[model samples]
Structures are given as C-alpha cells and as structure tokens.
Target: MKKILMQLKDYYGEYLLLIALAIVIGLIVGVVDAYFGMILLKITEIRSLSPFLWIPFLPLVGLFIVFMYQKYGKTSSQGMGLIFEVGQGENKVIPFRLIPFIIGGTWLTHLFGGSAGREGVAVQIGATVAHTLGNKLNLMKFQTLLIVIGMAAGFAGLFQTPIAATFFALEVMIAGKFIYPALIPALVASFVASTTSHFLGLEKFQVYLAEPFDFSLFHFLLLAIVGIIFGVVGSLFAKSLSILKSKMAMWFKNPYRRVFIIACGLSVLLLLLYQGRYAGLGTNLITASFSGQHIYSYDFILKLIFTVCTLAVGFQGGEVTPLFSIGATLGVVLANILHLPVTLFAALGYAAVFGSATNTLLAPILIGCEVFGFEHFPSFFIVCAFAYFFNFNQSIYGKQQILK
Candidate 1:
C-alpha cells in the first residue's frame, strides 16, 4: 500500500500536466476545426449552386493548385505522410505552411466541384497547432503523445464522436497496436474537442434505427455477406487510389501538367455523369440513401470511381466522407437484396466500410454506436467484425504500419 501510494504521488504531477495540456489542445483545435468545417461546407454549397460554371475550370484550378505547391509548399505537400513519419519516430518536422496550403487547396478543390472530404484538413490543422505548441513548450519527451491527442481532438471536433475519435487516433497510425500510453490524454482531448465544436455550432451526422429485428442465424449469414461486400469495396477503393496516384505521377512527369490534364479529363467525365452527381463531398448520396429517395444501384460504384479519380489527380480532401457515402449507398442496395431494414444496414455500412478501408476495428464499431444508436450494436458488431477480418489488411493511409 505504501509503495502504490508513493508511485501515485510520483506520477500525479505528470498526469495533471498531461490532462491540462489535453484540455488546452482540445479547446484550440476544436475551434479551428469548427471554422475549417463550416467554411468547407460553405464552399460545397457555393459549388453546388453552379457546378457547371466552376467544374469546367477544374483543370485551370488544378494547375494553379499544383503551381502553388511546387512554388511554396516544398515538402509540405506530403501532408499526412509527414505526420505519420513524426509519429513513427522519424524525427521529421511538419512545415507550418501545411496548415494553410492544405486548407486553401482543399477549399479551391471543393469550390471548383472536386469530390473530396474535409477531415484531412481538420486533422492536419490540429496536428500542426499541437505540434507547434508542444515544440514551443519544449515538451519533447511526449511529442508522440501530443500528436495523438491532437489527432483525437481533430476527429472528435469534426464528427462529434469522441470515443470513436480516441480509438481512431490510438489505433490508426499503427494497425493492431493501440497507443496505450496516450489513451487517457487522447480521451480527454477528444471529449473536450467534441463539446467545444458542438457549442461552436458544428453539427454531427446521426441516424436512428426505428425498427428491431431478431438476430437469427439467417440474419447473421446475410450480415456476413454484406460485410464481405463492404470489405471488398473498401479494399478496392484503397487499392485503386494507391495505384492511380502512382500511375498519374508516372504518366505525367510534371506536377502542373499532370493535374491540368487529369483534371480536364475529370471535368468532362464529371459533367457527363449526371451533371456533377459525383462531384463535391457526396453528401447528396448519403442523404438520399437515408431519406427514402432515389438511390440507383450504381451510385456507390460511380462515387468510388470519381473519388479515386479526384484524389489521384491532385485534388485535396480526405477520403472518409466519400467512403461514408459509398458505404451507405451500397448498404441500401444490399438491404434491398437481403430484405433487411435499410437504415440499420446503411448505418452498419457507413461504419464498416470505413473500418475496412482504414484497416481498423474498434473505431468503426464505436462510431456505429455513436452515430447510430447503441441499440444497433449487435448488428454493427457482427458486420464490422467480418468486414475487418475480410479486408485483407488494406489501408487508405499508405504509411500506416501493420503490427502483427
């Protein structure tokens, strides 16, 4: 008892310090996240109002964005790769320019009818702020912990799912190995950031499952099938993006020319495909999936294709929101085929596809419970388990380490 008491006394100050740091980080990052998110949404709305007018200029806009990177971005264009390197002890520094470059570039992309997501910018913003602050404070020993805290806060602020964000930051960088040492600080940061963003008027997406179904063996089999489909789709998305990115680089040696040419092609195809139906963040498809509106079976596939093209050709944004849209749309089709509840499976797909794409497990399950109701836990668990197991270890983050 005396030894335990002494140990607690010795570590109490450290714990208190970390906790305080987490609150500060969360508050600041959450505010920035709200600002970024709200602006991005505004850009999306502006683009939607006149997609044809802006989408035709995607090639020019892409060239300008590439030129900006070539001139001023330097190594900052590596974006998330640098964050992973620092987290993995590579002793790299993320350029402060990354914050503005990504935000501006993403805004341009969206404003010009690019199909992308915003969480990447939010995460980068949080990391940049937290990392800069930690360095200024000379908190060298806990840099990795601080970065994880920032990541958690960033995700929580945007999605308002603190538990899921905590798990995501803990498990995302290194698959199969949660960052146990930073769990407490990360959790604190996540909750604080979530609350701050909510108070700042950033809304979270949620759905309710009004119907209940018995979890019989037949239902289990059907869910497993759905999981397998989601897993395959997620894997395909990651793989296609990776391959296309590389191919685009190889095909066009210059960044400016590459973006210009590809964006031109994308502009034509995007307009031809239902007058930019696959443009922007894909929230329209997600909304349609849940609102009993028209959802063609091909919606998911087109979204996957367009999103892959958008990012491969130097468009800015995260793949997460698009993944959510794809999963939800696919879920609608699967539910129709399986004769299950549409909303329940749509919710499951929203989480499971994200899990499979990121090669994660717990984060998606928690997101399902958080975004959908906790009553859907059983179905979510069954589907996510199979999805994770069948993903074959593909991940959207190429730098993510697979821990065996």
Candidate 2:
C-alpha cells in the first residue's frame, strides 16, 4: 500500500498537467467547432435560398476543390484517415493545413449544394489541433490519449453531447478497444467543449421523446425488428460508400476530371430531383422527420444515394449528419409500417443508424440519450445493440479497424 501510494504521488503531477492540457484543448476545439458549425449552417441556409444558382456551379466548385487540395494540401485530403493512422500508431502528425482545407472544402460543398455532413470536418479539426499540440509539447508518448481527448472535444462542441462524444473518442479508433486512460481527460474536455460551443451560439439539435413502449417481451421483439432493419441499412450505407469511392477512383484515374465529371451529372440530377431536396447535410429531412412535415416513403433512400455519391466523388464532408438524417427519415417510414410511434421510432433510427454505420455502439446509445431524453436510455441501448451486431462491423471510416 505504501509503495502504490508513492507511485501514485510521483505520477500525480503529470496527470494533473495532462488534465490542464485537456481543458485548453476543449476551449480551443470548442471555439473552432462553434465557428465551423455556425458557418456550415449558414452555408446550408444560403444554398437553400437559391438552390439552382448555387448547385449549377457544383462542377466548377468541385474542380476548384480538387485544385486546392492538389496544390496546397494534398496530405490534408486524407481527412479522417490521418486521424486514424495517428491513433493506430502508424503516423505521428496531422498536417496543420487540414483544418483550413476541410472546413473550406466542406463549406464550398454545402454552398454549391452537395449532399454530405459536417461531423467529419469537426472531428478532423479537433484531432489536428490536439495532435499539433501534443507533438509540440513532446507528448507523442501520449498520442492516442491526446487524440481521443481532442476527438471528444470536437464532437461534443458541435453536438453538445459530452458523454457520447467521450465514448466515441474512446472507442472509435479501434473496434473492440477503448482508451481507458483517456476517459477522464476526454470526459472533462467533452463537457467543457460542449458548454463552450453552446455559449458561442452553436445550437444543439434536440427533441423530447416520451416513449410509449415499456420493456415487455413483445416490445423487445418489436424493437429488435426495428434495430435489425436499421442495422441492415447502416451496413448497406457503409458498404456502398466504400465501393463507390473505389470504383469512382478507378474509373476516373484523375481526381480533377473525376470530381468535375461526377459533379456535373450530380448537379443536373440534384436539380431535377426535388430541386436539391437531398442536398447539403440532410438536416431538412431530419427536421421533416421530427416535425409533422411531409416525409415521402422514399426520402431516406434518396438521401442515402445522394450522400453516398457526393462523398464518392471526393466532396469534402462527413457521413454522420447525413447518416442521422437517413436513419431518422427511415425510422418515420418504419414506424408507420410497424405501427409504432412515429417520433419514437424516428428517434430510434436517428441513433441506431449512426451507431451501425460508424460501428460504435456506445456512442450511439449515449447520443440517443443525450439528444433525446435519458428516460429512453434502455430503449436506446437495446436498439443500438441490435444495430451494432447486425451491421457486420462495417464502418464509414475505412481506416477504422476491428481489433482481433
């Protein structure tokens, strides 16, 4: 007991320093996420106002985006891939330029009406900031822990869901592994960042959901069916994204021509189909799902296709927001079909689809509880569990590994 206490005493200073650094990370990342989220939302609103005017320029914007990356920020284009590499101990640095490149690229993609999401950009931004700080301070020995803390800060700042962000950062780097040591620092950073961003005017999307289903065997069975369906859709989304990215790369050969050509066709199709209904972050669909607005049976599938295609052609954005939108929209349809509460099922899909697509069960459950009410925690767990196991371990992030 004396020896253990001495050892703890010796290391306490280092641990305290790390905790202090986490506070700094949280504040910095929170500010960045707030600006990023606010601007992205503004961009989405701008595109919504005059879809035709902005969307027709998608091909030109795509060309510009490709040119910028190739010219000044080639390594930065790796985005989440670099974050994964650093976490996996395969690489040590994330280019500082990644911050500007991803944010700029995503803004342009949204401004010109591309179907995509913003969470990826936020995560990358957070990772880059933390990694840079760690490297400069010679904290490379704690690289994975720092990265996890940064991820949590970034995600929590944008979504204002600290617990979900903490677990997501902890578990997302490896399929079966959680960075236990990072838990304390990450949790602190997540809460701080979330509060900071909320203070900075980045709003969190939340809805109160009072569940109707008690934990009966019949309800469990019914939720299982819903979970299974969401899992299948999530897996399909991940698989389709991977295939499309590879196939498009092979077919185009030149990234410039690839993005431009695809963007041209995408521009026309986006214009033709509901006049850019499926464009941007799919937040519109998410809103429609929660509100009593009209959601067609096909809203989910169309959003899925558009989001997949947009990313496949090298558009800069995250898959997560669109995934949430896809899941929520699908949940509404599924609820109607299954004779369940539309809002409740929509909430379920909102969480489960994200869980399955990202292949992180804990994050989804926590996010569901955070965004909705904690009273639905049990339901979130059951649905997310079903979705996670049923997804076949597919992930939108190609670099994510299933630990053996």
Candidate 3:
C-alpha cells in the first residue's frame, strides 16, 4: 500500500494537469465541431432538395477549390498527412488554416454533389486547435500526446461515441500499436467532447438492433466469413483511392485541369446514376440500409467508386462516413444472401468496414456496441477481430507508419 500510495503521489500532479487540459480541449473542440457539423448537415439537406441546382457547377467549384490550394495552401494541402507527420515527430506544427480550408472545402464538395465525408475535416480541426494551444502553452515536449487528446475530442464530438473515439485516437497513428501514455487524457477528452456536442444539438446516428440470436458455433463461422468480406471491401477502397489519385494526377499533370475535367465527368455520372443517389456523404444509402428501403446490390459498389473518384480528383472531404454507408449497404446484401438478419448485419458492416479501412480494431468494436447496443458486443467483437486481421494492413491515412 505504501508503494502504491507513493507512486500515485509522484504522478498525481502531472496526471491532474493532463486531465484538466483534456477537459478544456474537449469543451472547445466540441463547440467548434458542433457548429461545423450542423452547418454541413444543413448544406446536405439543401443539396438533397435540388442536387441539379448545385451539381452542375461542380466543375466550376473544383477550379475555385484548386485555386485556393495553389495560392495559399502550402503544406496545408497535405491534409491528413500533415497530422500524421506531426504525430510521428516528422513535423512540428500544423498550420491553423487547415481547419477552415478543410471545413470549407468539404462543405463545397457536398454542396456540389460530390461523394465524400466530414470526419477528416473535423479531426484536422481538433488537432490544429489542440496543437496550436499546446504550442502557445509551451508544452513542446508533449506535442504528440496533446494532438491525440484533441483528435479524440474531435471524433467524439462529431459522432458522440467517446469510447470509440478514445481508442481510435490511441491506435490510429500506428497500426498495431497503442499509445498507452495518452490513454487517460484521450478518454477524458473524448467523453467530455461527446457530452458537449450532444448538449449542443449535434444529432448522432444510431440504430438499436433488437433481433435476438444465439451465438452458436455456426453463427460464429458465418460472421467470420462476413468479416473477411468486409475486410476485403475495405482493402479495395483504400487501394482504389490511392491508385486513382496517382493516375489522375499523372493523367492531367495540372491541378486545375484535373479537378475541372474530372469534376465535369463526375457531375454527369452522379446526376445520371439514380438522379444523384451516390451524392454527398452516402447518408442516403445509410438511411436506406436501415430503414427497410430498397438497397440495390450495386449500391455499395457505386458509392465506393464515386467516393474514390471524388476524392482522387481533388474534391475535399473525408472517407470514413462513406465507408460506413458502404459497409451498411453491403451488409444488407450479404444478409440476404447468407439468410441472416439484415439490420443486425447492417449494423455489423457499419462498424467492420470502417475498421478494415482504417486498419483499426478496437474502435470499430466499441463503436458497434455504442451505436447499436452493448448486448450485441459478442457478435461485433468476433466480426471485428476477423476484419482487423484480414484487412491486409491497408489504411486511408497514407502517412501513417507501421510499427516495427
């Protein structure tokens, strides 16, 4: 007891300060994320009402987006890469402009019917705010740790999934490696941010799965197979986006021309395909998947393609939400084929596909439980374990390093 008491006494000061800092970060980030997310949602609604009004101008908007980057973006154009570099100690600072640039760029992307997501922007916003504050406070040695706290706050604030956000911030920077040192601060930040955002009226997407089924050995095997499929789907998404980005860059050899021409082509296909069904964040597909509406078997593939092309051609947005939509829709198809409960598997896919793509394991499992119901955690755990193992180490964050 003396030894334990002495150790606690020795570390209490530092721990207490960290906890306080985390709370402050969470509160500030939560408000910022709430405002950003709510505006984006409103933009999505307006676009949904008349996709044709804005989608036709995608090419023009693409040119303007490209111009912004060319004129003043500098290292900011690196996007998530900048965050990874900072986390890895390869970079010391994240430019503050990254927050507004990404938020505005993503808003423009969705408004113009581009297929993309918002989490990436939210994360960048959180990291930039946290890192900047840390720098100002002269906590130079603790840069990476502070960034992790901010990242957790950002994700939790946006999704209202604190546990999942905590694990994601800890594990995402290095595949298969968790930063135990930052766990406490990350947890505190995530929970505080989640609560703040919820109170600020940022709605969370959740599906309470009520179907009951025994976890028989046969059921385990079936879920394992589904996990593998989701893993491969995630693998394909990361690989395709990376390859397409390179090919488009090579083919155009000019940023302005690339975004303009590709955006034109994308605009046509998006409008033609079910009258912009694959537009925005793929939320339509997500809604359809769980609402007992028609989810075409080809829906997932089209969303994946459109998202890849949209991002590859320089459209600004994140990939995570679309990935969730893809997984949910694909899960519906798999459930039909495998004769399983559609909603349950849809919930599973919503988490698993994201796990596979991000090369994250625990976050997806916890997210599944949090968003669905903890009662189904056994199923999510088994499926996510297999999905993580089978993801082939693919990640959407190219700058993320592999731990040796």
Report clashes for each candidate as comma-separated counts.
0, 0, 0
1 against 3, candidate with superior lDDT = 3
Candidate with maximal lDDT? 2
* TM-score against truth, every candidate: 0.97, 0.98, 0.97
Write the residue-wise lDDT of candidate 1 on 62-134 in tens digits: 9888889889999888878788888787855778898889989999998888888887777777777778888
Q: Write the per-residue lDDT of candidate 3 for residues 1-404, one digit (tens) a residue.
A: 99999899868877788788999999999999999899999999999999889899999999998899889888889999999899889999799998888988999999999999988887888788889888988886788888889899999999999999999999999998998888999999999988998899999999888799688899999999999999999988998988998899899999899999989999999999987899999888999999999999999999999999999988899999999999999999999999999999999999999999999999999999999999999999998999888889898889888776
Extract clashing residue pairs from model 3: none
Q: What order do you get sorting by lDDT, best first?
A: 2, 3, 1
Give all candidate RMSDs, comma-separated.
1.4, 1.1, 1.7
| Per-model CA lDDT versus the true structure | 0.88, 0.93, 0.91
TM-score of 1: 0.97
Candidate closer to the true structure by lDDT (higher is better), 1 or 2: 2
TM-score of model 3 vs. true structure = 0.97
